[model samples]
Target: MTALIEIHNLSFSYTGAAPHDVFSQVSFSVAPGGVFCLLGPNGTGKSTLLKCVSNVLQGWHGAIRLDGRDISRMKPADVAMGIGYVPQNQNSAFPFLVRDIVVMGRAPHLAVFASPSTRDREIARAAMETVGILSLADRPCTTLSGGEWQLALIARALSQEPQVMILDEPTSHLDLGNQVRILRVVKSLAGTGMGIIMATHVPDHAFIVATEVAIMNRGGLSRKGAPETVITESNMRDAYGIDVKVLHVAGGVERKACFPSL
Candidate 1:
């Protein structure tokens, strides 16, 4: 399969009295129709990497190519047209209708001073239906539950008609059932030829949904491979600094920390 997106020798740093580099020499590629997960402990720069790929953050050193074209040279609107981003949280400062929020995804393709056409509305409605939130179209976004709001946010992203979707901690603040629902939706989308990249701290989620896993530690990619190859006990320890025993469960593999009797 061809690579839908590629990052070569990527590095990012923050300047201060004492400069700190968040990530260095990171390189990876996502094939079309692939589900890739970035896993690590907190403060590992996983979200930072996602932001860079989505063109939310600039001034990075290295090459990012989307569909064989250099992304760094592309305009932000063009990048937004090709890539959709779902942040960790949803904060609505003002009251906006659910449909209105989702419609914002079409901004990349809209002409200045023009209203959304029937086709645009149809697309946004289809996206809302995909996430099972069509009934809430006219409701205020602030009234949604955390899980519902997250799904709506994803629907908004889908409305952009992007080929690649990047999500940051998508399962956070959700119940177990909702988490499974969201993961299933994401997995299904990837199966349909959308390149999906998700950053998650939960190993179980990565095990269930990701075909490829990239373990990040201290702002660098430590391991990248199939889930079974990269989700080993040693890699878990290196990425999370914890000793764990991986067991095969009824549904999937499970990771449990090992502790000596005191």
Candidate 2:
């Protein structure tokens, strides 16, 4: 199967008085229906890398292809139609209702200055339903809690119906129940043939949701493979600077969980 997203020799750095490289020579690919999880500490360029892939960041030294088409050369609308991005931090200047916020994701499919039609709204509502936030559809986004806002953003991305979804710290600010819910949604989406690339601090999430996991640090990926092969005690220590025990599930689930040694 063709890759949904492919990165070749990707590198990025902010240009200013002091140019700092975020990551260098990073390469990866997400096949259709695959969930690729990125595990790293803060400021390790996981978000930056995701942005590059989503065509939200430019001036990077690499090629990111979406379904074999170079994203840099694709039009903004084309890229938007191909990649749906859910950022870590979400903010809105206006107090739009949750449903309206989600409907904005259909912007790429609409003509300039066109309002979202009934069909667009229906898609948005379905997306909200998928994220279990349809009840909040009438609520003002500014009135929601952080976790609720995150879910709204995710619903917005889902409404886009893009081929690939890029999520940066998708479970941030979520409660335990919501976290598990979102992970389950991620896995379910992958099952439907939508490629997912997610950056998350939770290693256990990778084991739960990712088809492939990569530990990124020091400007590149240090380890990448199946969760059992990549998320080891030493790898966690190297990436997170903490000691953790990687344990298997007691049942025949073939899953691993990590806990602090302390």
Candidate 3:
């Protein structure tokens, strides 16, 4: 299968008091219809890498190609059209209607000063239905719960109709049921040939839905392979500095970590 997005020898650094580098010579690719997970501890640069792939960060020292073309050469609008980004826990301070928020995804296709056409509304409604939140379309975004807000954000992303979807901690603020629902929606979308790259702190998400796993540590990709190959106990320890016991589950491995004795 051809890769929908490719990263080759990518490197990025942030300006700080001490000038810290977040990534160094990172390389990976996401194939069409593939579900890839980025796993690591806090401050491991997972979100930075996702932003680079989505073209939100610029002047990186390597290549990011989309459909075999250089992403740097693509305009921001074009990039937004090709890649849909669902950020983590977007708190809308103002009360925007849910339908208005979803319709913002169509900005790439909209003419300036023109209202969304009937087709746009149809697409937005369809995307909302896909995320199982069509009933909340008219509600205020701020009035929704965390899970409802997440579903609405995803609905907005789906409304973009991109070839690849990049989610940064999609299930971060949700409870177990909401987490399952979000992951189920993401899995179902991947089944329909949408390439997905999601940064997740939860190992269970990768165990259940990810076709491939990339473990990041110390500003680089330490392991990349199928879930079985990459998410072992030793790898977990290495990446997270935790001693974990790996259990063989019905379909995948369950990870249990041991804390240091006092």
Q: How high is the CA lDDT of each candidate model?
A: 0.86, 0.89, 0.86
Comparing 1 with 2 on lDDT, the higher-scoring candidate is 2
Q: Give a tens-digit lDDT track for model 2, residues 214-256.
A: 9889989889898899999999999988999999877777778
- The best candidate in terms of TM-score: 2
lDDT of 1 by residue, 1-262 (tens): 8898988988887551113389988999888789899998898899999998888888788899999999888878788888999998788999899998898889888877987888888999999999889999999988989898989999999999888999999999899999998998898889879999999878878878887999988768999998878888888877767777665665443533223122
Measured against the true structure, the TM-scores of the candidates, in listed sequence, are 0.93, 0.95, 0.92
Q: After superposition, how far is residue 46 of candidate 1 from its true place, in Å?
A: 0.7
User: Model 3 Cα displacement at 92 (Å)?
Assistant: 1.1
lDDT score for candidate 1 against the true structure: 0.86
What is the alpha-carbon lDDT of model 2 when measured against the actual structure?
Answer: 0.89
Distance from true location, Cα of 129 in model 2, Å: 1.7
Highest lDDT, which number?
2
Better of 1 and 2 by TM-score: 2
Q: How would you encode candidate 3's per-residue C-alpha lDDT over 126-199 as one tens digit per residue?
A: 99999999999989888999899889989888888998999999999799999999999999999999999999
